[model samples]
Target chain A: MTEVATFLFSAIRVSTPLVYAAIAAVITQQAGLLNMAVESMMLSAALAGVMISGATQSALLGVLGGVFFAVLIAMVIWYSAFIMKCDLYLVSISMNAGLVGGTVFVMYLATKQKANTIGYIMSKTVGKLDIPILKDIPFFGEILSGQNIMTYVAVIAVAVTWFLIYKTKLGLRIRSVGENPSAAESVGINPVKLYGISFALSGVMAGLGGVYMSMGLMSYFARDMVAGRGMIGVSAMNVANASPAGSALFAMLFGVSDTIANYMQIIGIQPQLIAAFPYAATIVLMAILAYVQHRRYQKYLAKKLSQSGFEI
Target chain B: MNKVRKIESIFELARIILALAIAYGLSLLCLILVTEDPLEAVYMFAIGPFTSMRRFGQVVVKFIPYALCGVGMCFMYASNRFSMFGEGAYLMSGCFVAVVAFLLEPFNLPLLVMLPILLIVGGFFGGLIGFTPAALGAKLKLNELVTSTMLNYVCLYFSLWILKVYLADPDITFFASRLLPDNVRLPQILDRSTIHAGLFIAPIFIVIAVIIFFRTRLGFSIRICGSNRDFAKFSGINYYKSIIWAHTIGGVLVGIGACVDLLGIYDRYLWNEITNYGFYGLVSAVLARKNPIFAPLGAFLLAYMHTGASILNYTSEVPIEFVQIMQALLILLISAQTFLRKTKNKLIFKDSQDAIMKEGKTA
Candidate 1:
């Protein structure tokens, strides 16, 4: 039970960034856009959040800086895809390329440092918030209490995103635009506008996620640090079919697989192999899904062909 | 009409040059940010590759496989699939050929004939790498990029697994396979140049790719499919077949890259990860706009920059991230509308819903 408790808590913390990016990915995908820049956004935000707070000696300033740069990169992505007519996903790649480089470039500019920086930004980490009368509670406290403020934000963000996606007018437009753009266009909806806004919002979500990760987790920004979370978000997005709640759940599952890596490895395989847990899991899951879908599609095609009595 | 054509041509050239300039500028920014001796380090990073004949030769040798991968990818991307499976294919090809050379020590076969045979086998199997996602895309309707990327890991890991299980020399310290027999090696060209038989192999196949691409009905069908599948259907082209063929030819090129890198330099089968040769090759393809013949120059330029970065590494505390940043710059520049064609948008994207559905299904 103690082991289980420790594993779950660590899993939630590690899984937080994936959740943030996955949430961001879901919102963007909802608007018919595939943004690959989430990784870049997170990296820049982590740095900015860390740097600002480090400079100001204020965690709030660090948070603001992180959010600021992430949004800026998001805007750049929006401009390229929306106005430039570049493929949104590819543009995301371009933005990712630019953002990471941009952050690195700025790091050199500000600190005259090469790749990595010294200390967490503001030299301040996100402090844990102890809920009143909760520490003495058993499982509930173990799971929920003694967590950072960002944990609550992630929880609230997940809830709000679910609410917005299912119960809001903007959600309908986003879904409509994504599903059938031509149809949406006929109904006086701007597919590009919806996508642009959604992508920007996705960037912001990713930004917030990055900020929380930096201050709340490591309390410092490192270069090339986002690693594979962006790709993980891509995995989570696919697994959940862009459903916010589903994505968050999958992200946690992914985090658990990752958390296991920190512990003992099965057989002789190192934690590095298991570090690819989310990707490997998604690949297996996807293959099965594809086979089923293929069967279903073939059946439908066969039924339609048979009814027509003529092969077109 | 001629004047208008001239202006458009001028603008296109301008864009290409501007993009290159920006790519360099970004690297210069890295130089500035490292806050080093701006002029000295930047100059070394840019012009350091040409400081001497040996350096030039080293640059050429590096450019050799890069060109091989580039021209190979040119054929594949020209066929309109944005697949980077060549990375795994090239690495595996090199590894396998290394293994084969170790076992086959027969003196009966002539050097020329034996080398071609190995090259052909390597190319054939290497081409097999291209078959997966191309097939998956056609048959399963999956997004080729995601499928190809995953397949890369599968191929890389599977190769490592094979190496660990079958090929491990028990006494050796590092994770590497057995050394190759001397009889299977390519005669080095100039003493200085890394130039091997594979460098010549690239051009030979590139010519074939060009002739096949422009002169044959099959090639025409590929171009048609890339332009419009619906139109290709009316013109009697097989989209699936064309994709497969393109990837197959691409595989051959990539395989040659592996074989050359293996047989020419290192005589052992060992690679911990897929080399960036495939990515560089893809960059050459993008820069060349899928034109097979134009790939060498682009490949050389990218290689030269890599060498320059190597030079930079010697002089400073700057990380390899600088080179990767250059890669990002190259991708951005190459994928831009004018640097290549406006075709990047068409080839690189799928319908969002379709892509999500396909990638999701595969994921």
Candidate 2:
């Protein structure tokens, strides 16, 4: 029972960054853009967060700087895609490659250390929350207590995203523009401006995810530390059909897989095999998800045909 | 009509020049911001490759793998599929070739007989890995991008395990295979420079790719399937067959390129991670607009910039990563169709109007 509680707690902790990235992905994907630049934004923000926090000795300033940098890059992406009319995927690939190199260069320039890590900087890492009365509850307390503040923010972000996407007027405009840009234009909505704003919101969410990686999870920044979480977030958003609650659920599933992999490593499993588990799990899960969706669509089509009295 | 054609060609040339100019301008700004002596850094970046034959040879050395992979990428891009399995294909092919070469070291076989066997085996394994995502996409309705990306990590971990268990050299602490035999190594083409016979293979393959792309019925089928799938299907082209064949051939080309790079550059398989040549090749393919004939030129340009950056890194305190930023900027500018669309339209419009007025006078 204790092990299960510990596992659930760790899964929530691991899912926090992924939850943030998925929110970012959901926003852009809803705006009719496939933004693979999430990884680049998160990585750049991770480095920026660490550097700023180290210099200013304040986590709040670091978070602001990180979000600002990510939003700046997101705007550049918007200009490149909308105004310049570049292929979005190609722009994303280039930005990812550039950030991979740029982060290392900037890290070296700032700290005079190797490009791999900034472990010596003693940055302000985010503190964990310990709710007073909640901490005394039996099983629930064990599962919920001692998580980073970002984890709570991630949960709140899901609710906020849900409200913004389903309940607000801007959400309607964004969805209409995504569904059909021409039709939206007929209604006097500027698809380009909405897309730019959506991209900026995605940047903000990805920035928070990046900060979680450096400040909430680890105390220092490392090269390519976000790894493939951004991509996994993309897959989660797809599986969820761009719904915030569904994205959070899928993110938690991945987080569980990650925790299982880590546990296997601790129990003396081969490190290489353990490393492959999360990716293999993702592939299998994605295949299953695709199959289920296909079956559902087929069933729905058949039901509609039957109701309309069409021949077999 | 002829005058309009000439103007269109000139506009295309001008667009490329403008993109290059912007990329270089941004790079200059970066240097000025980062370095103490920005002018010297810029000079070294622009002119250093020509200062020595060795540096020029470095450009040629980098060009071979990039051009080969670029040509390979043209096949997949032509089919309009964004599969990223090429990175895994390259890495695994190198791993297979190293294993083959290690086993063949004691046979004392002739180099002519041995090299072809290694290339075929290496390419076969790479194609097999590449076939997975294609087959999955066909059979299960999966996204090739996600599947291919996942497969890359899977292959990386699998290869690392193989190296640790079967191929590790106990003498070395790092995860690397044993040194390959002399007979299996590529012969040098130049005395002072590290230019190898493998460099010649890239151009030959490029020529072959160009011929196949331009002259073959299969190539036409592939292009049709990419541009208009419904039309291709209506015209009785087998979409699945064309797509599978394109990806398989692309995988073989990249695999061969990986083998060449491993044999020509190093004595042993020393890579613990992905070499990223496949990504560079993808960039080259994009730069060439998925045209096989232009891929070599694009690869050469990228390699030249990389060589110049390395020279700058050696001479000044500036980092070599600036080249990556410059390359990204170049790709962004070049791929932007609307960058100077107004200017291009005006030029073509003027030419067409001139042609119309000439016809009116003649009549």
Candidate 3:
């Protein structure tokens, strides 16, 4: 029972960053932008946040710095993609590569250390929350009691994203722009501005994800540490059809797989092979989701035809 | 009419120059902010490659694999699919070459006998990697981008496994394969530089790619399919066959590039991660606007920048990665179709109006 509790706790902890990234992906994807540069934004933010926090010794300043850097990068992406009319995928890929190199370059410039890591700097880490009432409960409490503040922020973000996306005026405009930009423009909504806003919001979420990586998970920045988590989150958003709650669930599923991979490492499995499991799971899950969506669309078509009294 | 064509070509040249200037400007700004000796850094970045014969040779050596990868990527981009399996194919092909070269060492085979077999095996495996994504897309409707990206990681891990289990040199502390025999090593082209026979081989493939792209029915079908799938279908082109062939050819090129890079640069296979030559190739292809004819130029430009960056790193406090930022800015600026579209349109419109007026006056 304790083992299961420990596993669940670790899973939740691991899922926090994915949850943040998925929410970010959901926002931009719903706004009809292929924001492949989220990984870059997260990486830049992670480095900026850690560097700033290390200098200032303030976690709040670090988080804010991270978000600011991320939003700045996102705006650059938006400007390049929309205003300059560059291919979004190419721009994002270039930005991703740039950020990877930029982070390492900056880290080396700052510390004259190895480009692979910036762990030596005594940066501030986000404190974990141990809820009093939750800690007193049983195995369930053990799973829920102590987690980083970013984990709570991630949970709140899901609800906030759901509300902002489904229950607000701007949400409607954003969705309209995604579904039919011409229609949105006809109704006096500037699709470009809305898309820009969505990108900014996505940047905030991705920034928080980066903060979680550096401050919540580990108090240091590593080169390419986000790995393919950004891609995994994008896939989660795809599998969830851009729903905040659904993406959160999928993120947790990935988190579970990740936890399993870590546990397998304890049993003497090769770390390299184990590292590939989450990516493999993501591919399989994406295929299954695509198949299911296809079948559902077929069923919906059949039902609609029958209702309209048309022969199959 | 001749004047208009001249003006248009001049404008095209200006666009590339403007993009490159802005990219360099930004990189200079970064250097000023970061380095204490900014002028020296800038000088190194701009003129360092040409200052030495050795550095110039390094640029030539780097250009070989990059150009091959670029040409390979041109096929896929021309076919309108972004199959990123070139990265995996490069890695896997390198592994395959190491394994084959090691196995063939016992026989003490001559370079003539071994090289062709190595190329064929490398190309076959790489093409197989490329085919998997294409087949998956054709049959299952999976997104090639995601599948290919995942396959890159899969290939990396699988290659690592092969290295650790089968080919590892126990004498070395780090993960690396046994060194190839002297007979199997690529013969150096230059007396003092690392430039090898692979530089010659790279151009042959480029010529073949040029021929295949322009003088073949399959290439025509792929181009047509890429431009308009519905139109291609209406015109009786086999969409799946064209796409599969394009991707497979791309994979073969990258695979061959990997083998060349391995033989030219290293005595043993020591790559623990994706070579990233495939990504650089992709960048070269993009910069060439997916034109096979211009891929070598694009590859040369990238290789030159890298050589400059390495020189800058050697000369000053600036890191080599500063070139990555410059490359990214250049790509973004150059790829931006709308950047100077209004000016271009205005020039063409004015020229056409002038021509029309001339015709009216003559009549």
Candidate 4:
């Protein structure tokens, strides 16, 4: 029971970063752009936030500062795609590289550290809130109650994104742009503008994820600290199919797998062989999604043939 | 006298000169910002390569594979797909070839017989990995960029796992493999430089790639498919077949590059992560504007900066990791410009603007 409880806790903590990244990536992808810059965006936010917090000792500024810098990066990518005749993938890879260069360049100027920041930022971690009656409850209270502000924000983000994507006019435009930008433009919709907006918003979300990393995973900004979360989010996005609720669920599942791997190391499991498991799982999920898409495509063709009264 | 000629000449010069200026300025900026005596580090890192015979040799050692990968990537990009078969080829073929080299190096076979065998096996593995996305793209008409990038990571993890489980030397705690015997080592150039036969091989292959890209029927089909794909389909160019060949060629280059890098530089293949060499090659291709012939020059520049940055790291406080970051910055700048220019061409805001101009003239 205790092991299960600990695992569940660890899962949520790990899931927080993935959830932020998945949501960020999904928003951009749904707008007909793959935001590979999310990695840079996240890193930019991480460094900026920590610097702000370190200087001011204000956690809010840390969160804001991170998102602000990430937004700036997203804007550059958006403008390049919208105005210039550049390939989206190429632009993304470049922006991601630039993010590292720009940040590392600035890191040295600000702190004189090469690999990481020089200061120790002790920004406040999100305080946990326990409902009085819920706290009295046996296992339910312990499992459900305590999590950081980002956890709450992530939960709310899932609900908010679901409502926005399925129920709102903005979602309609986002879908139209992704499926066929030419057609979207025919109806007076600005596909480029939509992409630009979606990408920036996605950057904001990814920036928030970086905050969770600094405040929850560790207390300070470090070099490449987001590690593979950006790519992990890419994996989760495949599973989610850009659906907010699906992404959150898969993000949690990924977090759980990560938890198992982390604890198994305590029991002397080989870190390396087991290390490939999450990526393998992600690849499996990608293969499964492809299979499902192929099947659906075949089914749609078959139905269309029958409806048209075509020969069998 | 000729407007088109003048514009072309100007833009061409702008491309090369501006790029170099950025590179030079960047190094200067790093030196100035990171160290008190910026000139000393710059001189040591960049100019220092030619100052010593040994260090000059080191540059040659690193230059071969970077050039090869860059040229290969140029072909892939020219096909209008970010297939990036280089990564798949690099990891799959390099790891397998190294294992074979280690196993065979002990048999005392003549180095001549062994070298070709390893290179072929390496190139074959490279082509094998390339076959995946080419086949997938032909069947599903899926986006190649995302798929290829994702696959790179998967290949990295899979290779790392194999390296750890099967190939890692059990006697050593460090994540290195059993060093291969010296029998298969490439003959080096004279004492003036560390130039190996691998350096010569890169140029030869690149010359062949240039010939194949321009002169051959297969090359024509690939180029046609990239430029006016619909026209190619109308002409029965077999777009799918062309894509396969393009990626296959790319994979072969990656394989050869991996082999060259392993033999020319390090004693063993000891990568715990993706060799950014493949990525750097892609950057070279991008900078070359998908020109296969020029790609090697681009690759050389990138590789030189990388080597020079390491050289810089010794004397300056600036980290070599910053080189990776700056390279990324250069990529983003070029990629963004390319992406935006593509968008403009596709939309032709000019067409609409031209229409408005015509109406205004009539009014």
Q: What is each candidate's DockQ, to 2 decimals?
A: 0.17, 0.64, 0.59, 0.40
Q: Native contacts retained by model 4, as a fraction?
A: 0.41
Candidate 1, residue B240: how far the Cα is off, in Å: 3.5
In TM-score terms, candidate 4 sits at 0.90
Model 1 chain B: lowest-lDDT 10 consecutive positions: B343-352
The residue pairs that clash in candidate 2, if any, are: none
Candidate 1 positional error at B162, Å? 4.7
lDDT of 3 by residue, B1-363 (tens): 787787777776677779888887888788888888878887888788888778888898899999999999989988987778888999999999889898888899999898888888888888888988888777667767667777888889888978888899999888898887787789998887888999888899899999999899988998898889999998999998899999999999999988888888788898998777777887888778788999899899989989988888778767778778888888888888887778987988898899999999999
- After superposition, the stretches of candidate 4 with alpha carbons farther than 4 Å from their true spots are A117-124, A129-135, A267-269, B1-6, B137-143, B170-173, B332-363
Determine the backbone clash count of candidate 2. 0
For residues B1-363, could you state the per-residue lDDT of candidate 4 as single tens digits? 244455445554465556566756775676777777877877886787777887777776777888888877776777776665567679878788877887776588987888899899888988877777677667655445545655676677778877877788887778878876686677776766767889777888889988999999988888888788899999988888998888888889888898887777667678776676667888888777778877877877777777787777775676666676566556645544452334344445555667679899999
Writing each residue's lDDT as its tens digit, candidate 4 over A42-135 gives 8888888878887777888888988898888788777766775567777776666556666766776777675665344445554566667876
Return the lDDT, model 2, position B221: 86
DockQ value for model 2: 0.64
Label model 2 with its docking quality class: medium
When sorted by lDDT, best at the front, the candidate numbers are 3, 2, 4, 1
How many clashes in each structure?
Answer: 7, 0, 0, 15
Candidate 3 local lDDT, A1-312, one digit each (tens): 999999999999998888988999999877887567778888988888898899899999999999999999999999998888887777887888778888888888888764544556778988999998989999878999888999989999999999999999988888889898999899899988998999999999999999889888988898887876777787788778889999989989999999999999999988878878887778777777778877888899999999999989
Worst 10 residues of 4 chain A by lDDT: A117-126
Q: After superposition, how far is residue A294 of candidate 1 from its true place, in Å?
A: 3.2
How does chain A of every candidate compare to the true chain A by TM-score?
A: 0.89, 0.96, 0.96, 0.93
Higher-lDDT candidate of 1 and 4: 4
Which digits, one per residue and each the tens of the lDDT, describe model 1 over residues B27-105? Answer: 7886776645878788878888899776776687787788878888877777766666787787667767765665566
User: Alpha-carbon error at A195 in model 1, in Å?
Assistant: 2.2
